[model samples]
Target: MRLLGIDYGDKYTGLAISDAKPSLAVAKDIVYGKTRQDLSKYMQEIITQEGIDVVVVGMPLGLDGQPTQQTKKTAKFVEWLRTVLSVPVEVMDERMTTGAFRAEHKGSARPQRDDAQAARILLQNYIDRHYDNHR
Candidate 1:
């Protein structure tokens, strides 16, 4: 099973893809300044091209697990994705995903690269949890 991970942001969205075995997540690309419809369409193209089985989006929430404005925006995006995509769209808690990337990269971090890395972390976390539970 293949999976696509998305780190949705206001200006730029990051994307990641899992290997065919769905074991490792790799940073794919960063999409900048796209409308919601355009983004969804782009995702659809990727879904078809990559043969993705599922899409995992990073769900932004407050540190206390409460929904914030960003969380609401992400929810709206997820909802929009569900309406347009054929495959299942799921969200994984993305708390500290960016922090994790920043901590690892430190001074070397670039905004575009960091976003993709954050998506990679989020996807890898989901893959790990899923495999661990199944095992």
Candidate 2:
């Protein structure tokens, strides 16, 4: 089953997908901003197009492991996501993911790497917890 990873942002949302093994989640594309109501529709398209069996969205926790405002926003998004998506949606801790991306990948490739790498980090964490360590 394919699992999709998401890095939610204000203007845009970064999207990634796991391979059939649910590993190696790669950033597929970005979903541009639309009206609040339209965001669900846009996400539905990605879910269908990628044949995603599940979703793993980034939860932006604070450095102290507390929920930031953005984390609350993301929680709202996840609640909304469940209605639009046919598959299950999971939230993965995304603290410092973007920061890590910026640190590792800086340059012309920065923009793409920022979101993409974050999704990878989120999905990889899920994969490790779900399968890698267990197996």
Candidate 3:
């Protein structure tokens, strides 16, 4: 099954997709300047086009594992997605996902792509953790 991963942000949203076997996840794209309704519609299109069976959204929790304001916003976005999409939607902790990507790149000038890379890392972690169990 293919899985789609999302890093939800206020202004920009990053997207990633898993392979057909779902063993690997890669950066897909970044979406911006869309209303929530429009975004959901766009996601539905992506789901259909990419044959996504599941969606995993990154939940931005505090380092203490407590919900932060951004967590609340992410939850709302996830809820919205769940309501609109036919596939199952799940959440995974995304603490330090962006930082990890940034640290790896270090001096790279591709700040705009950080969100997509972060989503890639987040999805890769999820795949690594669950792929074995599912197999």
Candidate 4:
């Protein structure tokens, strides 16, 4: 089953996809949109083209595992996405994936699209924790 991972943001969103075996995740693209409606449209197109069976959205939680404002917003966006898409949507904790990515790429002047990379981390985390368990 193919899976799409999302790192939701206010201005820019990150996207990643799982491989055909649904074992590995890779960065796909970054989507820029003004509103959730616009983001949903872009996501729908990718989902259709990639034949995504599931969507794993990264939930931004506080260090204490508490829900942050962004977490609530992402939840709403996920709810909207669920209404439009036919695939199952799930949320995975994404606390420090971005920080980890940055730390790994420290001292680099190159533009690292952290959002997409974080999405890849989020997706891979989900696949390792959830899909692997099922298998």
Candidate 5:
């Protein structure tokens, strides 16, 4: 199964992808949108072109293990995506993905690639955890 990873945000959303083998997650693109509808349509096109069977969206939960405002927003986006797309949507914890990205690019001045990197980190983590369990 091919997988797509999403780092959903209000202004910019990052995307990553996995091969049909569902092996490694690779950074794809960062999508900018004025509204959720625009982002959803753009993601749908990517899913069709990439033949994505599943989508793993990063859920930014609080360190206290509670849902934050951003988490609620991501959930809404996931729900909307499920309605419009046929692919199965999943959530993966992304509490530290941004911090991890910053650690990786410590010297950079706001790297434009950070978003995609965050997506890759979350997606790879999910793939490793879930796929390993299944195998």
Candidate 6:
């Protein structure tokens, strides 16, 4: 099954797609969500065209394992997503993923892309830990 990863943000939402074997996840696109109109159409189009089976959203839990402001926003977005998407929406721990990505990539920057990549990492981790466990 193919999984879609989403990095929910106030201004933009980063999108990523799981590889064919579902072993790798890669950045696909960035959707502008800074405005209500943009947010509505962008996400609707993605769900329509992607044929997504599972949606994994990144949760920015702090270093101490506490939810941050963005974490709450992400959670709310996930909740709203559930009402729209027929498939299940899962929240994955995204602690340190974004920061680590920034540090690793250093000078080179693609915040939106990196955000989506972070989502992919979160989803990949969840898939490896839980989905594979059922097999």
Give lDDT per model, in order. Answer: 0.92, 0.79, 0.91, 0.87, 0.87, 0.74
Cα lDDT tens digits, model 1, 1-135, are: 999999999998999999888789999998989999899999999999999999999999999999999999999999989999989999999999999988887787466457888899999999998864353
Write one digit per residue (lDDT tens) for candidate 3, span 1-135.
Answer: 999999999989999999998788999989987899988898899999999999999999999999999999999889888888989999999999999998988886766568888999999999999888464
Candidate 2's displacement at residue 36, Å, is 3.8
- Report the lDDT tens digits of candidate 5 across residue range 65-100: 899999999999888888987788998889999898
Query: How much is the lDDT of residue 44 in candidate 1?
Result: 92
Residue 65, model 2: lDDT of 97
In model 5, where do residues sit more than 4 Å from their true spots? 108-110, 133-135
Q: Over the stretch 1-135, how does candidate 4's per-residue lDDT look in tens digits?
A: 999999999988999999988889999998876577777777788889999999999999999999989989988988888898778899889999898778878888635468999999889888898765465
- After superposing candidate 3 on the true structure, give the runs of residues whose Cα lies further than 4 Å from its correct spot: 133-135
Model 6, range 1-135, lDDT digits (tens) per residue?
A: 778888778876777877655677777777664664566466567666776678888887888998889888888888887886767888888787777668778887666457676766666776787655453
TM-score per candidate, chains pooled: 0.92, 0.85, 0.93, 0.91, 0.89, 0.79
Count clashes in each candidate, considering only residues at least 3 apart in sequence or on different chains.
Answer: 0, 0, 0, 0, 0, 0
Q: lDDT by residue for model 2 over 39-120, one digit each (tens)? A: 6676678778878788889999889999989899999989988887788998988887777768776564666436767787
Clashing pairs in 5: none
Which ranges in model 4 have alpha carbons more than 4 Å from their true place?
Answer: 109-112, 133-135
Ranking by lDDT: 1, 3, 4, 5, 2, 6
**Would you give me the overall lDDT of model 2?**
0.79
Residue 50 in candidate 2, Cα distance off native in Å: 2.3
